[model samples]
Target: MLLALILALGGTMFLQKAFTPKLGLDLAGGTTVTLSPVTQTGQSPPEEILDRAVNIIRDRVNGTGISDAEVAKSGDNIIISIPGVGQSEAIKLVATTAELRFRQVLAMEATQVPQNLSTEAPTPGASPSAQPSSTAKPSSTARPSGRQSATTPSASPTGKALSSALTAPTPGATPEATQTGTGRDQTGQKQNNKGKNGTPTPAPSTPPTAPPNQDPNAGINTQGIDPAVLQQFQKLDCADPKNRGQGVQDDPNKQYAACESDGSAKYVLDVAKVVGTDIDTASAGVRQGTVEWIVQLDFKSKGAGEWSKLTTTAYNAQEPRNKVAVVLDGVVITAPNIISPIPGGRAEITGGFDQVTSTQLADQLKYGALPLKFQRSSIDTVSSTLGSDQLEGGLIAGIIGLGLVVLYSLLYYRGLGLVAVLSLVVASILTYTAVVVLGHNAGFRLSLPHIIGLVVSIGITADSFIVYFERIRDEMKEGRRTLRAAVEVAWVRARRTILIADAVMFIAAIVLYFLAVGGVAGFAFAMGLTTLIDIVVVFLFTKPFIALLARLKFFAKGHPLSGLDAERMSTEPARTTTPQEA
Candidate 1:
């Protein structure tokens, strides 16, 4: 028992930074984001696509080093809960489609679009080519919008209405895709207006300025992109996520409108020259002599030829077209000038990226892109203070339950009750140590259900002691053995019963853990762990302590209060009766 306690406590103390178990979302505070699929062409994507998207999202969340984060699907929506994360950071981290592409910059134009422009679907018969006049002079000043930049035009009801109709919803997008939020923090509150119906509502603040790596004068193919396409580019805003209007998931063989994530500028990008699937592997590292973090990309054999071809084209092209844009989900991540053809099948993206952002990018690149886009359905956040309250309540409930068990044992079993109480303490120590160690090393957080599981285990441990005590009393009542002998015989029977009972419990827990979803699985896991601990404590501590106590005079003599009085347990009373019998 001493060795067990030492190993459990020592291992936990060594592995865990803190002595406490990690808490789940409800008890530790965090952010949750829900994403629903957006089909490309009015038909639902294949099951494989949705499954692959889930895997990609998992990789993306894991890239942030959030081991306790939970990602699961409910019906059609994918839910992501990240403990100890903020709303803005969580959204920025997991909300991206990460559909990376290497596209040429065809044209750059600045035109302002109204914030309240309705993003409604166009009439079925409307001409596909109908667009705003290309003759309109370009504005020099463009403000950041969402994750893109477009010149904000003077407010005109006519212009707003026209822009609304022209920039229709994607063919298969939800009629009114909307994102709601449980704003427990400033970041969450700010992101509450992300989506309304199918429209991209304006954010209260302008997007951040682009990093220093972005070149303002990167050459664009002014002669290549049609004026109408350029006009559309002028209306685009990267700041408003919803502004990625109809057909934004462009065909690989066609020109497209896109923006920089920081809303620094907008671009008319040529067809994709290279895609994410071409990447064989990606990793983030600091440059040899600099503190700047970079993402190194390695391509597969076929991708090598493609990469060589793309680089050669960029190297030979005019100014902006010579700069290949690394675009993700129609937003330009970076556009670096091609100085020479890179045929080595490897390249590095150097930006003013910190370790966190670089690592996130590398993970996105390493995992293949999602086949379908997702609209942010909702975001929820829990404050740490609230989580603390929940944790406190759970702890109080558990303490009360434990106290009741201890009280019952002491009141009923007399001296042996001390043994039961001590056994419980030992079990609790082992359980706590196990939880903490598992939480630290295996990313197992103690959620509310898991806490309940632990509390319920009090009964399980107490039950084992009760079984052994009763069996020992039964043996002594037969009057064929001393207390020591009774204990030995009782243990043989009790051990089998204990094993059978614990086996049933462990099997049930195992089944639930594999079949159940979400928090229930955590509960199942905790239950199984404690059940196993119960068996260990009984064998290592409870039975051994009982045997030792039986050897003591107080217990072996069957003192009335020892809870093991052999005479009191015997069915036959003492032969000598009182005066009434005489």
Candidate 2:
């Protein structure tokens, strides 16, 4: 029965290990970021302060494109579990206080701005920092733009004629003269006046000279500015048509307009009146090598006509500027200089990008606005190397703990201790196999705490054996003639107490696991697993082993090592038993 029970438990554990998924910190790495309110007089912060802080922290985490992150309050402290956000950005995001503010760019030029520079700008709102330590490392500077140096990536390839962009070209000239020597015709043939291709019909090759005529629309007129540059920004407007103040006789607050240069010279853009929230849907995906994403922006009825007008103006421009900047969290992600006006308004951003970053951008834009700003309180990175060292230490401790338990139990309990030793061996096999299987199945990770729990449980296993042994001694004192009857009676009482003890532990563990945050959950889970293993060992291995021993002559006759004497069982004290008993 003992062997059968062991085999069954072992097999079941092995199967579970094979099929179950083990939990991982990264896969479900639940971390608690604790935010304590700044305490006056250096005591604990007040309840009201903590509550407000937690609310804001929760808001920031939810906005971060991380799924399943949670925040809750505990006695003057806020605990946040940034779950399912893997080890990388999880550390970066949580540690960031996200203390956003509209600090005016003050001066980008070597010259100072005039003090009266009031184009009434920007906005801000805040609750407080969401952590105990109010300190945060200063944010790193943004990567430098390449435009400051010629070596920097040339301002996103304009693809416009170089001459027009270098110095504005004329408003009038023959189409042939206006185009570059490398440009194409309606039939897609290269139109080179230099006779690089096509039939060189024959040129009398007149010498280049100053124009005799000052006609504004005349041939090869190289004058004041470029017509192509004028066409590029002719109708740019920042305010969406639908989003002007209540009734628009034109909002005096609209701050942006089409400029001679691309937005490079502009630092501030108009506040979005009709934000991304008005749009119904947006999604991002990767096709081939490019990151392709689309936004389906439908305007509020009031905004639609205005948006159409904005597009029409851009559409009717000399060169036609059709694209608007795709902005998010106050940063421009991409600006595709459209070749034609998009009255439809909805647009696509196509560039080389992997699937993940594209999806994250779309999610942020779709969410519109965040309710609260988060201040990252603390961030910690746990390395796999440390995890491995911890695992090794735990294993060594478990083995040592088990060896000590075995050495002492054998020296003290004699034959009774053997039962405990066997039960533990079986339990160890089951636990080890289950842990491995669970690693694969549930993504389970056995931290050092779990190993310690297993080692401590060795004492719990021994206690059960001691309880049964003591119960059997009581039965012997009550004058039981048969070993089997005494064994059976003792088991009934011992099983009850054993079960009750395990049940209480299991219940406590369950409650703690669900309620406690972070590392405490690991503690609770290990306790619960061990409590379960304890019960299995008792019901299947212990009881069956004791039952099988009852029928053995050595045990029935009361062997000395077994600490059993028939005389002890029989109250008359005649001592009818084996010589070992004497």
Candidate 3:
């Protein structure tokens, strides 16, 4: 069964076309990015801020399911190394400041390039009479069939009527850009001008200005909004990437015009009611009684009161005004409508979220906002040749170590050495297959430290064989039982010792793996894996094979070359009772 299982796993690897284990940055070479801190004041950022950024960036990378990525703090800069070339998405994820804010949705419009603005420039002093081509009305009560309700508060239940408004597909919408967690209009075709990271890069040009008399919020209530903000909203073309506001640090005291993360719609959002710092904690989970993924938020004491007030105001407002926008990185990720007053400090943001995206959003929110902003200082591609040289050195060292262990086993055990050698061969095959399969499925990668761990396992495996063989020899020297009987007795005693030793090593590996990071963790993981493999081989193959060999004529009769000769072992003389003594 074990052989068949190995064969099946091998077949799966072949089918998946994963011949080699994924290598780490030190073994395969990857991209290294340096991010320099950009503080509000031109002074250098403090050490704690840099350390905080490092931890957050590392969490973001791991949350994306990319293994073997390293994030470290240098002098006033953060360095990230990912185990693949052209990791643009990873680069963007780490570089983004992930500043989250909750603002009321003042007005919304479908993202479109105005035909007049595209064809001809607007006349200089004439009143700009062109209104938005299409206005998107808020539909917070629109629920998709067969899905759970969008938001449900612990204090007050809103029922199914309140759905995720942003997830509802807007008619006549075009997909031009990519957002982290926002829903897309599947009915529209994707645009071709998107950059490699799925962010649209439109042609660079000045945004057309509106006349002084124009009111962008013409029919809406613009009570608390500034006139200047309204003018900017009137001229803002969300379809243009430059106007989408990628890295702008929006002030919480001001109103702003922002594009949806997916660029499906544009919105004029009110002043921030709750900021990212207000969040006490955030997490992602599946909704009870349903499989829909959602992001749950818990606000701080003061923030909770502010959130309640914001939800109450939105619930009492008109169509579009009833929705609240969740803005991150100066872009609206989702704008769900307020169905009822959500008094509790806790809330959930549900939409077309999958497991990966939900976790990513949760991580960004949980880590809180960075104390300082960052700009990409340099992106350098590491050469694979360097990795190759390091890998070659590690492999050579492992080979030398393995060769010595095998040589010692053969010389000391004589004919019994063949069994030890075969056991080693089986253990190697099992380890290699496991590493390859795990690399393909779990994103595990082999690094220099992992190589060292594998090499050390050679001695561990050989020690198991030596213990059992010595126990058998000791039993045979007593001249009480035959070779087969001695084999069974020796195994009973040896296994106890073997288990204890392996248990100790495994425990140490587990502790080390959890406490360490980067290459040290890799080493611990590899050691633990091989240690388990060693136990499997001993119980399933080594012990059983020795039992079968004991039944052979050469071994049963204690042949000299078999390393089980009676003369070789100091056997006690047979007891003969004298006639008088009897």
Candidate 4:
């Protein structure tokens, strides 16, 4: 089972190219800083307070999944290094003391419509005249005319005849020299009035107002509204579903909104309330009925009071209740006008959310809570050159260390050194496979420390071989009849000792892995992994292989190339008449 597991793990590492360890600062390349207590009135922060703050910052950092992040204390300050991740994101992560707020729009650009006309009013039935969709554009042929009608007695003879005579065109008129002595109509014919001098007199302009069809819905035709107002209208980007693209979301300055919707009613809206900061938590989830996604927020006590008050006012208004918006991290998550005062502190923001969007909101809100209010210390682009140099240096050291191990084993062990060599070969195979597989599965990298662990493990593998071989020699001196029998006896003792040693090594690796910080933890983990593999090769490939060799004449008859020669072994003398055959 053990051998199978080892082989499988190794194979997986080799075959898959998947590994995603949280990278260290050097490899990932990002900024680092120490944040000191911003003392006021020369008072320093208490050590305990600072430590608690660090813990919260650490949680936010680790949630990021970047490996080998260094968060430590230096004197009264905290040092944070963000490698291989965006500094802006990290800064945002820490900086948000989760100061949530809901601010009312006090005043908006004049182009934005007011509280009454958000365009969400249900169009009960379609009217061809109301066909201007929000996406519709103005057309030249659809121009409109404006007129004012009065309830007057044109029925009186003088009034009636005077209007007709003054307004009427002459019967045989070439062009009416019907120049009005007063401000009266050449009303119709004045459009083509005659003049003796023929100075080409222009038609008199009428008082300006919205033309019958030059509607606000045609949107701020410059003649209809101020040009500066038109510019403000264009800058609008309303995220509101009803007037979506009509104007920007609730501007802090928007006390009133004036919207020119496509064929929709022109309305002015008054913001009754501002969104409050202080939501306890925000989560995104599916709403009931249609399974639409929504952001659910639980407000802090004070914020709840503020929201309830706002809702109360909106609910009592003549219009339908529920107009409060829940803004998260700034974006309006959901802004449903209140139909009634929200009884409790819970708010569900239902826009057009999906499962993925809900999950994203939940995640953001989850980590967004922080212990410390962060101030960005510094930011700059990082260079990978230093990391490359370190990697090269680490590799060189590993090669040198491996070379020494090979040299020592070869010179001292002589013929038996081949077993050591073979064990190393197997260990390397196992170790390399594991590292590769771990890289794929867990995103591990081969740092200098990790390489050192592998190289050092070669000695551990060699030790197991020496222990087993020495055991075999001991058994032979004790009258074990054949090399194969002696091999079995040695294994019994060698196996127990190997197991004990491996247990110790594994425990140490785990303890160190958990306690140590930065690259040291990687070292501990790699060491533990290799130590287990070493045991596998010794028992499966090493012992069984030696057993097979003992059956061959070349090795059993003590060939010099065989590490297990008779001369190296202490053979027991014949015990004459020693024991009756049992």
Give all candidates' CA lDDT scores: 0.65, 0.45, 0.71, 0.50
- Candidate 1 lDDT by residue in tens digits, 348-426: 6644467777877887778767677788898877555447677788889999998998888878888899999999988
Please, what are the lDDT tens digits per residue for candidate 3 over residues 1-582?
A: 668867977997999998898888887888999999998788898888788888888777754232678888888888999887888877877888778888997776655443333222111211111221133332322222222223432221432212222232221133222223222222222224556776554432332344678864545566666878877876777767776555667888889888865455677889999999999988887655456677888889998899889988877777567778888888876676565666657777765577877876787788767667889999998865448778888889888988888788777777788889899999999999988988887778788888988889889888899999999988877745677778889999999999999999999999998778887888888899999999999999999999988777767777677777766676553222222332
Candidate 4 lDDT tens digits, 1-582? 647866677556446644333334665476676665554445667777777767666656554222445578887667787665566656555544442334322122112223343322111121111122233211101000111010010112222111100111001101122224211121111133435765333332222345766753342213323344445444444424355322132434343333322211122233324343355766665433234455566767876676677656644532211123334433333233232344356555433346755655454455554433445565555654347678667667767776776677666555566667777777776676666666544446565567667767767777787788788777766765566677788899999998888888889988888777666887887888888888778877888778776677655555656655555554534121211211
Candidate 3 C-alpha RMSD relative to the actual structure: 11.4
**Model 2 misplaced regions, further than 4 Å:** 1-390, 566-582
lDDT of 4: 0.50
> In model 1, which runs have C-alpha deviations exceeding 4 angstroms?
1-5, 36-48, 51-77, 87-380, 384-390, 572-582
Each candidate's TM vs. the true structure? 0.51, 0.41, 0.70, 0.50
Best by lDDT: 3
The model with the greater lDDT, 2 or 4, is 4
Which candidate number has the best TM-score? 3
Candidate 2 lands at a TM-score of: 0.41
Higher-ranked by lDDT: 2 or 3: 3
State how far residue 478 of model 1 sits from its true place (Å): 2.4
- What digit string (tens of lDDT, one per residue) describes model 2 on residues 1-582? 546655665676666546333433434355556655443366765566556555545444544211335577767556666543354454434333321111111111011122332211111111011211222111101111111100000111331111111111111111122113333332324445446464222212121343666542233212322454223223333123222111111121332222111122212223233344455444564322222232223444544444445434433322212223334433333332222323333434322234554554454445333333333466543323234456667678888888888877677656767887888898887677656655543435655455666777777777777788778877766754456777788889988999888888889988887776445666677778878888888888888897787677667667767656544344554233433342
